[model samples]
Target chain A: MKSEARKPFSKDIIHIENIDQVCNDIIAKLKMDVTKNLQRRGAIVGISGGIDSSVCLALSAKAFGSKNVLGIMLPEQDSSDDSRHLAEKLAATYGVSTLIEDITKALDGFGCYERRDEAILRVIPDFDKKVDKAKIEIKQNIAENIPAIFSITVIKPNGDVVSKLLPAREYLQIVASTNFKQRSRMSMLYYHAERMHYAVIGTPNKHEVEQGFFVKYGDGGADVMPIGHFYKTQVYQLAKHLGVPQEIIDRTPTTDTYTAEQSQEDFFYQMPFESMDLIWYGWENNYPAEEVGKVMGKTTKEIENIYKSFERKRKTTEYLRMKPIF
Target chain B: MKSKNDVKTEIKKYILEASLSDVKDVEDDALIFENGLLDSMGLLFLIEFLGETFEVEVNDDELNPKNFESINNIVSFVNNKLSVKV
Candidate 1:
């Protein structure tokens, strides 16, 4: 059998052509999207002090003027201590007007933590609600072509931990409850937007949006998604070019959803963002699994499994992309 | 004012508008969230849609997945609320 000729996948394009031009283009589009289409006077963004939100705020300020952009620091009980400070610092640097909305009350009214704790108890019977515990390391049978088996590990008080595969009902309960954070924030943003007649901006990048890393109507709800077309790596480039604070850019990407410190990699994506990006790009372009494995320094089977997981995640989370059943 | 069938039709319309998946032909008894056709946020939208279109208030206690899991369930929920009001 003859080998098929491989198409060139230039990693440089990932760098993107003239980062400044791309930034300007996004700014222009954001302006048009709000002014012409939505007829909104300004933009409201929930700044988590993450690279994505930082870059989004910087772009929005440039697009609609610093005064026109409202940077909201939406911190809940589970949010990190530094998240609010970092968000405030970024807003000050960007000259955007900032407001602090502590959503602890809202989340409590919805019984967010109570419902989430109930799910945790199902997996780890001995878990103490007062003590901080986290769930991680979901293993999937991608190559086996099975419905993905979800497992979560809970860290305990005495440094002992427990891990177990989650039953479907229990997993959904935990996720559904935790989703309150995003939804509550979305509702608050809309309240401000409705009062001021501004548009709510979302900060999800291409990888997060495509991989279903966001909760629907929560973080995923937005009047405008300014950077959804760019990958995580590319967003960093824009961050650097736009002069986002080094500390903000240097800080690692985190879910900040759980009480414990959890990196985005731990919560989602089996691999690091860099590797996931390339493999995702290659897989989308039909690059052979073996060839991608060679580049990523992985065996063919491992690459195939990662590719399969990527596909599985996208298929299962397709509902996030829907409008509503009309 | 709309009838029960009208409420169901409008609810279905909003679900279609909000969902990007191909759930148009799904059965009325189909489990939506379990099958990944709708999620928590989607459920929120469904609740709000029902409240606004049918003029019924959805309390915090009634926000169960079962009530919004299927078209049949939603229709039943709306009918029940309407009867209660009358």
Candidate 2:
């Protein structure tokens, strides 16, 4: 590990200038594409009150008209109450038509919670079903040279929490089970879209889409992706320009599908969004590890390890980004 | 409008393009989902493709595995829906 002191970097890492112009350009492109290519009059976005969805919704409203852009609030048992409230608040603020779809029944129909619990039990032997809560996280240990490891944390009723390393089978089960929520919401979106002759819009940002951080066919399923090109940092810029709610703007990103309040940082990317944006941008641009390390106040070895971790994730989740194999 | 055979060919092309598994010569009667040739996400793409290609509404209820189990099933489903539209 190196000291935290480092020299100034050359330029902005993931910052975008002329935020309004860029935002309007994105909106114009989405509008033109939807009207001409898709031949759809309107767009539908699932609003989680997260920055990504909020930006996408605002763009869609600007592109297709507030009356044409439908904002869907998909909430399940594990979803935070704030998710619905904040999403509704955004829809109202934007004058966009909104609907709520309670996905608890749909997730239950697929036995999502039960399957997830079964997987958790494999890692936490004495994990209580009633009062114990659990969440899974992926971590990279550069010192140990381990690219990725799945870990489970079980919080008992008495406030005792224990963490255990997960085997591949248990990890797979847990992820597959948690993914049911996204798929249920996607199904509901398509149901409404088909009836209304509207197109479904996906809200994945640059990091999630490029780094393979999404569940295939679940949250990844959409007729069009309006914000796939913007980095997480750029998304916040767009959100500010779009007048997204301040509470939504300041909220930390969370998986929100798990029973526990797990952050996207702990669950997937080992670094926070700000650092990740710079690291990923540097890596993608083929900047040397030493240079990136100097810029980010880390050692060259640390930067190299982060690049390795990113590639490992990309390779393992390549299937999510693939076209049907021939 | 294209014939059902043309529709089958189009659907076959989509399955071949969207599936990641090595299914170069998938049988029309083969169970695509059971054989792991297609998945939930693939099904969603197929639904979108069908909706766009046939101009038929594919609702959530029609996303059953039976409707997408094989090329034959997809062809029949599209034809049935198109017939109703006509």
Candidate 3:
């Protein structure tokens, strides 16, 4: 807390000299801090088989050796096959001992927590039963009581049926849930890092920090992100230089935010990355709205509207700047 | 063409194949995680990728954030591994 005294605003202004020095200087100083602060604590980072993490892990394994890093795959049942494949392949490649725990049950385990929660999950099972010849659609909204040992289901009278109320694979809480996965991995990484006096590292890229694309107190929670300063595209170049998998580099990047396979960009901006990246740069560089129109082939008014939409984002980016120094 | 640096360079080539992205000009210091560039699992997979590509190992305890912040950091990390007494 004492070290975090200065709260610098997000820089739309990129200094060439700072850029050159920051990457090395930041990593060296930060690594020393991570290694020294936690003495034996090592690092935990999840690799979703995407560009950023690939870049991050390459560095982590290099810093602490593959023997010290912990790679965990916490995925929901609806997770894409590529998700599992990428995690498994990446882990195998690094010689880092790995663990794959399917948390779909944990998510569904929400029903086991509370009586009302169970009742909410106590929807009409797909079972058919005929009782007393009174065909009341009682199975529609059946309520269930949780008693540790078992769930007691009570049929509702004429209640509207809960139609496929499965937990959202990736709701707004998807980002939060994803962050939870990272935090959970950290929980395990630190356990070993501390036991062995290894340091824990975080994985973040440059664009996200500048635009404030993460959930505050969620993914934002970390010991430190070694790759937090690198841009999204730069991470790819870095990853290539680091020798990640060919499959990973070619895939359309996705957090698999939903069962529908929506990516992070889609989940966050509801737009394709190509378009978003273009607009993001123009907005940050103070590219005139009219100029944007020319490049994007949109009318000036449309570009201005787009600019206005990002105006709030630019201001909000300040909120995600350096942690307060107090 | 057939040296430790070659292997390291090859490993770099594989790692760069990843598909994550950011909204801004993909420069350094843009917050990969914050920008939705990579998630926890993606980070894990990259660890696997490195094992396969570079034949280096990342133990459970050494996955800290400092070493993987950027390309330069990653290169430094790999250099350490290449130099480590196997």
Candidate 4:
């Protein structure tokens, strides 16, 4: 067999040129994965108005027919109103039926807010959960060779902002409490899927899956993940090709789990998806750091540091991707 | 006020307890993270422990993996911070 030539690493390395063919292939795989492999009648997609979920919903509609697909909107108290509005618009555009399951009460019953606020109070003694907004973010860029130091930020009702380095115990507790949102949403998705004899579709992209950005047994639990292989940039391409809502395609991706409005890049990824996608492509394909650095307008050492950061995340989060052992 | 030996012993004890691992032999230069002895969360707890036990502030700039890769590196980094304080 002749050895295949490798393409040069560049900014366009992750671009999907033939989107129609890609969508058709994905639709076929989804149809087979759900109908043949899982014996499911349709797909139940938890739409969040984000690009990845929107694309997944659109593709599910195409795979199982719009009438067979059901979109579930699981929103909590911290969820942005625009998320629900955009999700409704997305479902309407795809002609799929949607169910609004307000998970705020469920999360409240789980003490999600109370526990998370308690942890926040450890770092910010005066943090008032009733009127304050809080979020956690990494302190430095991933391109630097520094350990990621997560910090908590609180905004008071009067526009006063307070930020401090989060201690280990408090950070762990806050994250554990906030994770209820994902686990709750997952349970809701499974309930709808099982009741309707449908498969739950996962909306995680490559970075989310590879970097372990998702919660274990939470958003990570899915009957089928149609877009798990595509990078964030490629997901955008699929969204455009699938006629996803313009507003959704244009909207910045958010964590939506935090009370304060936080971009997905701020909460995780530590960089723009565009840059991350290209650099990850280069690193995964074993391109030299110098070559990637030249194209990215960064030094070779910076590219190396980013690669190291990626490796560290993958190594640390490996547990999230593991299955049960006997 | 603690010696380098004391720093090393404390870090090793923390690593073993935090990891919950059965490995008994933690060498002076063993790569804790690379060897899967501790994880990202464990690293955060270790940072907190070092700061509180040594009474030294770990600046954001000093949070480099190289400074905490091994027991030897952590001892040196703590001593450097202590000397700066002195």
Q: Output the lDDT of residue A25, model 2.
A: 86
Full-model lDDT for every candidate: 0.79, 0.80, 0.52, 0.88
Write model 1 residue lDDT over A202-319, tens digit each, in one string: 9999987998889899999999999998888889889999989999999989988887677887667656778778888877777888877777787888777677667767876898
Off by over 4 Å in 3: A1-30, A36-41, A109-193, A210-212, A314-326, B1-86
What DockQ values do the models have? 0.02, 0.01, 0.01, 0.42
* Candidate 4: regions farther than 4 A off: A1-4, B12-38, B59-61, B65-73, B80-86
Best by TM-score: 4
TM-score of each: 0.75, 0.76, 0.52, 0.92
Query: Residue A165 deviation, candidate 3, in Å?
Result: 16
Residue range B1-86, candidate 1, lDDT tens digits: 66878877777767666776555566678766555566544564565577667877665335444566677888888889998888
The top-ranked prediction according to lDDT is 4
Distance (Å) between predicted and true CA of A303, model 1?
2.4
Residue A297 lDDT (model 1): 82
Supply the TM-score of chain A against the true chain A for every candidate structure: 0.93, 0.94, 0.63, 0.98
Docking class of 4: acceptable
> How would the candidate models be sorted by lDDT, starting from the highest?
4, 2, 1, 3
Off by over 4 Å in 2: A1-11, A142-144, B1-86
Which parts of model 1 have CA positions greater than 4 angstroms off? Answer: A1-7, A10-13, A139-148, B1-86
